[model samples]
Target chain A: MLSVVILGTGNVAFHLAKVLSSNNSVELLQVYGRNKTKLQAFEPFCDTTDNLGKLAAAAIYLVAVSDGAITALTQQLAGLDGVVAHTSGAVSLEVIDHPRPGVFYPLQTFTRDKKIPFAEVPICLEARHPNDLRLLAQLAGKLSGAVHRIDSAQRRQLHLAAIWVNNFTNHLLYIGQQLCEEKGLSFSLLQPLIQETVDKIQQLSPKEAQTGPARRRDVQTIQTHLDILEAPLQKKIYQLLSESIKSTYEKEL
Target chain B: MLSVVILGTGNVAFHLAKVLSSNNSVELLQVYGRNKTKLQAFEPFCDTTDNLGKLAAAAIYLVAVSDGAITALTQQLAGLDGVVAHTSGAVSLEVIDHPRPGVFYPLQTFTRDKKIPFAEVPICLEARHPNDLRLLAQLAGKLSGAVHRIDSAQRRQLHLAAIWVNNFTNHLLYIGQQLCEEKGLSFSLLQPLIQETVDKIQQLSPKEAQTGPARRRDVQTIQTHLDILEAPLQKKIYQLLSESIKSTYEKEL
Candidate 1:
């Protein structure tokens, strides 16, 4: 069995600990966090501690902490012989000061309130040593079906790509909800449309899947939409995104 | 059985015809389109006609043409005694010049290539006459579980909201895919993240569900992302959206 120890009792850490503890092929040794209150949530699954010195020697150490604290946390684990992987998409494997520096980036958003099935989440793995990479891969393989061996540069790009897809997309939906609230319309009315937009890209490329006034360059409709938007930010966003969409399909238009 | 005549042979008209043809309660009488080529697709399901003069009398006439063509087509159907409803979200109920003008907008993006199940689609119905509205509600109820009685003003706002959720969201995904392509990373890597973002909003409001650097106000990560984006438009979008997100949570930050 591949033994794993998860550091940092955040959303990623809690989830990793939960999944690892339940897996028959793996042993979850311990979970560490600076906050004692957060560590309590992991108590039922495995050994939890706020003290870093109490960390056990496991085959893989998954540092599921904030991006800013990743380097500092990994520096503290420099003496560990096992593969030290930080569960961050943006932060590099180089940040880990351990002899066996690695990355165990799960390319999915995690929420403490919501339970996510890790099997479908693509876990991007990277390590300086081939054996360490394989060790991390085996641990990831136990937790998820989708495991990708990605370099630091590729992972960083994926993180940036994620910001556009998840972060920016969610913000747009927030804007939609705000617009609905302003007009006293139910935001739920637009839910199916949002679902369908995501569904369309599964079969077709985003460019091929794109439609609407901006793509068609229907100037009048765009103007009508712009006129109704009360907020300056909303109007600017509408104008900018419309222009971007138009420019994207400029040749076709 | 409620008899219905469909006008226009676009994506909306095609889907409506497909659903109505199979529905036992809906007698889909005839479909009319200016282009005979486009009308041919509806021939297997119902009587297809290129000439508006050849239109048959029915309980309801659904004008499913482009927003620009909606007014002119509805004007031509002025002599029809049936309730004439244009299947458009943005267009007003007044655009239908028939004696009983109505709106039967299915609030979902329709693509001819992908077959969407109508049962879950939100059909927003509006009419000047209460009886006509009830007739639409009945028809909408037959096709979809989610039928909403909405006024023209509210439906217009919903349409605007849809542009943000569906159109703008799709554009963001397109940008994400573009970023991945530029970096030689697999676009599919980000698919799971995108799905989770949509799924999160179903349970929580978009504001409550929001995450990433912008929401956390991580200026360092935001700057790093901005530095890597080489395209001018991409950089502008990142900056604008990051600024928008920061401004949104400015009070919290």
Candidate 2:
């Protein structure tokens, strides 16, 4: 059985603890957090501690902290025999400052209120030593069905992609909501269209799935749309994205 | 029973025919298309006619043609006593020269290959006369669970929102795919993250659902991401979107 101790009380840490504790093949030893109230959620599941020095000995120390705090937090876990790993997509594994530095990044967006299914999330692992990598892979397999061996550089790229697909996409939806509200229309009316857009990409590549006035190069409609947008930022975004789509298809056509 | 004749053989026309034909209260009298080969798909379900003069008499003549073709197509059905309606989100009802001009737009993306459930798709109806509006709403209700009486101005706004939610979001996914291909990573790894992002919005407002380095105003990570992106367009989009997100939360905070 692989013993794991998760450090931090953020969304990533909370989710990792839940998945690890549920797996029969893994033993979740303790959860360490600086905030007492935040650590209360993990108290019922396992041993909880605010003091870093009282961290339990485990096969692996999973540091699920913020990007700014990761390096400083890892420095505090010095002289530990267990492999030290951070669950960050952007931060490099080299920031661990340990002989057995590694990464156990789960490529997913986690919300505190929403419970994500562990088996579906892709877990990306990296380590310098073969034994450390094998152990991380084994633990990742228990938590998720999809496990990939990705280096720090590749992980950083994947994280950048995540921002586009998740962060930017959400912001676009926010803009859509604002547009709807301005015209006294219900945002719910566009839900089916939004869902179908995502569903199409599952079967066809995004390039093939693209469709709009911009893709068709309908100049009149594009001009009309630009004229309708009230916000300067929205107008700029619409122009840039439309130009990008037109250029992308122009090469193929 | 309401007899309806459909015009054109594009994705919108084909999907609308399927749903209307399935409803017991509606009779799909005939399908008119200029292309003989494309009209074959509807031959088994209804009478197919390439000649506009051969159009069968019906209570409603639904013109499901391209935006540019709608005006000319509606003019062709000039003498028909039926209520003439076009299924376009962008086009105004004023384009239909018929005395009983109307619109029966389904607010969802229709692909030729994919069959969408009619019950889940919202149907937006508009007409000049109350009787025509009632008849259109009745037909729309038979095909969909959600029906709304939207005027031309409001429908145009909804169409603009559709572009942001569907077209622009798809472009963002395309950008994400490009980044993944550059780093030799599978795009499938980001699918779960994409799914979660949409699912969260169902429960929370899109404004509340936003999360990332930009939302937190983490300049260090945002700059690192910008430095990593090679394409000028990609970098510009990243910076612009990040700035938008930062500005949005700055007001809220």
DockQ of each: 0.80, 0.79
**Which numbered prediction scores highest in DockQ against the true structure?**
1
Task: Give me the candidate number with maximum TM-score.
Answer: 1
Q: What lDDT tens digits, residue by residue, belong to model 2 across residues B1-253?
A: 9999999998889998888788798999999999999999998778899999988889888999888888888888888888999999998999998899999999987777777988989899999999999999888888889999999999999999999999999999999999999989999999999888888889889988898899989888999999998978778878888888888999776
For model 2, which pairs clash? Answer: none
What digit string (tens of lDDT, one per residue) describes model 2 on residues A67-167?
A: 88888888888867899999999988888877888999998888777788889899999998999999999899888899999999999999999999999
Tell me how candidate 2 scores on lDDT: 0.90
Per-residue lDDT over A1-253 for candidate 1, one digit per residue giving the tens place of the 0 to 100 score: 7888898887788888888888899999899888888888999999888888878988888888888898888888877778888989887888877788899999998777777878889999999999998898888888788999998888889999999999899999999998898879888888888989999999988888887889888888899899999988778889989999999989985
Sorted into a CAPRI-style docking class, model 1 comes out as: high
Worst 10 contiguous positions by lDDT, candidate 1 chain A: A109-118
lDDT of 1 at B240: 87
Deviation of model 1 at B38, angstroms: 1.8
Instruction: Give lDDT for model 1.
Output: 0.88
After superposing candidate 1 on the true structure, give the runs of residues whose Cα lies further than 4 Å from its correct spot: none
